[model samples]
Target: MGTNQVEMCPVARLIFVVYLLVTTCSASPPNFVLLFADDLGFGDLGCYGHPTSITPNLDRLAADGLRFTDFYCTSPVCSPSRASLLTGRYQTRSGVYPGVFYPGSRGGLPLNETTIAEVLKPLGYATAAMGKWHLGLGQNGMYLPTRQGFDHFLGVPYSHDMGPCQNLTCFPPDIKCFGHCDQDVVTIPLMYDDIIKQQPVDFLDLERAYSDFATDFITMSAKKKQPFFLYYPSHHTHYPQFAGPGAAGWSRRGPFGDSLLEFDSTVGNLLSTLENTGVLNNTLILFTADNGPELMRMSRGGNAGLLKCGKGTTYEGGMREPAIAYWPGIITPGVTHELASTLDILPTFAKLAGAKLPMVQLDGVDMTDILVNQGPSKREAMMFYPTDPSVRYGMFALRLGKYKAHFYTRGAGHSETTPDHDCHIISILTPHDPPLLFDLESDPSENYPLSLQGRPDLQALLQKIQAVREKFEATMEFGESQIDKGIDPNLEPCCTPQCTPKPSCCQCD
Candidate 1:
């Protein structure tokens, strides 16, 4: 009888091993739905302690997922930040430094760079970019999302608020007001798979339309039994924060609040689609912003809570963003203080999907263990890139563990209004000879700069950072499109009814 029991145990173990292999193979790889917001602040959502923004959907999503409080964006502005998130490399390495591109810029993500979608394509994932493709309007669709691995691309070629209109009523009148300058400037084209679907699309109609496109993509992907990667970079919460008819006046905070309400609905609709398609539990939805907020707009923009300064600066408020990752039944719901960034998403998703990574050096570390088993993130250091400066000393910060050293101090809480092309670009940055050091663990707001007179350790840390910066800046390459130039309105895609009342030939699409 004892011999029989031993033999039965061996048989039981074999069956168990086979059973594990079968079940794991039957389970599908988790789908990825990256919801990227533009110019959203840390304190914009109820979960992040906003006083008035109605973001129940986002708040609930945060409650159901891992909320990362210390997450950061690679750059403080749009184009470079977008580049870092897609390629998981620094703006300097990717040649996307100094600034964002306007429409029809000759620069974009180089064709050689491997995007997250490109790497995941071999893994049978259906990829689609459903909103805000702010990475330059490539020459002849050279750098378009469709060319960069997205099966379908639908969004504006650039920002919604870049066009030829010069109406004073478009925004608070200023010679520098490049956005919301009228129905024309803010009314950029809407695109669908390389075709300009409509020139000067109503900005108010976009959020809902993007939501529809996202939901439809999810339904079709689920039906086809293919795990999908949907990059929904929403254009709301930027400038001209307009809401659709159903979402208008939904919040008490004004147009920004109305935009938040509509944005919340967009999340709710996407959640419903996931739930309806039975993919909610098998999908990982990462919600975060490209950068902090546009602070120059005062109350019209966003609030970064206790973080100092705002967009286009190297301050904490400019780069630190609110991030959440939701994968029901997979990621244990909770908040994490781990230091992560948008750069980590590409590598993390690669590991999650069991896909082969590109044979390129990456600035991002795989955060899979931290996301899945709540393990410690091995990320120890992060370098901060100033918003739009070609020179290294203009403004840059380097974070090593809890201590952060700022090589250059810049304007804080001041709006840099480009009044005209002739005016010198507004900048508050002042060169720091010895650099400023702050213990981020104690001073998250960075209000009080530490006295390096007594702390040799801090001084040595700064020296180390300076050495790293010197080595990095030596290899820095700049792209032609990233030279901080606004789009020539003449290059704006297609004309509105007023621009060409009866267009039968040019830009008819």
Candidate 2:
């Protein structure tokens, strides 16, 4: 009998239908899960050479796929870095430069700019964003994740430390509160889409809540046989650190380490969900941080391994981050030191998902070859911009091949006694006439600057860097600075059952 003519039992028909669904999903476009950590250092994970930080899941992820030794975020601070990452362009191009967006800032990433989510959504991907979204919240929440192309959004509007927190005991005693720690300060809202679900979030439960939400999203997408893009920018290891119940005091590195452990566990949970849902092999997972460690936090902050300086500087420690790419059957397991940046994510994902590039000019190049076949990196040079608001549209450093030139050098102070000390305030902003050059391959810590007095080769290198810089700046069109916009109290979100006093009294279970 022909296959079509053969009569089958109900059980057999059900089994056949399930087989077809699985086969179709396997042949479909791959899913994407990007895990972005806040203020996590290059040396924070066990895979990245952290001696005390417990990160078994991340370690496993590295072992199973590609581990990048020299990956970077375009900017050294939160908002600018995130803006560049999503748009695949420089933060200055998107107008998210000068600094991060405050809670009441009306400005946001320009609506004209395209994001990775927007690129994938038209291709039938279900996109979700969990954890921090410091981009901005424009009038009536017009620039939130929902408007930014994410199908589901659940997280804080900005940094966790932006709001009031009466309790100091949750953090390690050694970690001083550099931000708001009083009850009188504006309360940070825990948002679900555009709605403020909870005010003054119980941070102790945040990690768990985020994990649960992400897992649910993954499972739901898998059941519907839909491709998904999960952008989980974790808030752990940021200031005012707090760990979930399971991870508190679980690591020897104190609260910072404990928070990382909780983040690692959450990673484990997501990976397990992918595997259980039978989509692990079909998913392209990437784990990276927004920027370098917050060294000002002292003992409470993360370690940058051998890299110099930390957040708020153009040094390697400030922009270089730990990055891992995992795709079970697609990406070969190995370590690569090829130059790459967060900017490459959007373009690379577009290439992989068969999505069209946005009309706007993009600073990022596709690194799909590197991810798939262990090919050489498409990027050759990278620019380092200042995070300080005082320095506007300035390229402080540039790295070409193995040589890095620092036209300007500044250090973000790391001192426990001086709480207010920052890069712009304490450190001298030194501009080099010839520009200080360093061989990053030999000196990742940037301790030694090469002398170019009598060396023709070094002189040529500097000239080449200058040429590159000139060409880069010649075509550069800086957008209006969104971060410079002053804050507005009226823009702050309030819960559904509005309270008498507004945000301060806005609370929900």
**TM-scores of the models, in the order given:** 0.85, 0.90
What's model 1's overall lDDT?
A: 0.75
Model 1 residue pairs with clashes: none
For residues 1-509, could you state the per-residue lDDT of candidate 2 as single tens digits? 00111233466556544543564345467899999999988888898887888999999999988899889998888999999999999998888977888777889998888999999998789999999999998798888999998998999988887767644335443333345553444577789999888776767678888989999999999999899999999988887778866888789998888888889999999999999999998899998999988887876778788887778788888899999999885666778888899999999999777789999888999997677655578897999988753334368899998899988887664322222333433677888888888998899888789998799999998889999989888867888889778778677666643456755665566
lDDT of 2: 0.82
lDDT scores of the candidates, listed in order: 0.75, 0.82
Q: State the TM-score for model 2.
A: 0.90
Model 1, span 1-509: residue lDDT tens: 00101122445445544543543355467789998998998888889999888999998888888898788998878888999999988876677766777765667777788899998898788999987888877556677899999999989877766554333222222222234433433345788987788665655567778888998999999999898999988877888666777677678888788777888899999999999999898788999998878877767678788787678777788888999998775666787878889999999988777778889778888987566656677676677877655653533777776777887656533334323111113455566667777877789888688898887977788788777767666655544435444444445455443555322212333
Worst 10 residues of 2 by lDDT: 1-10
- What is the clash tally of candidate 2? 0
Model 1: how far is 168 from its true place, Å?
13
lDDT value, residue 379 of candidate 1: 75
Q: So what's the TM-score on candidate 1?
A: 0.85
Task: Please report the candidate that would top TM-score against the real structure.
Answer: 2
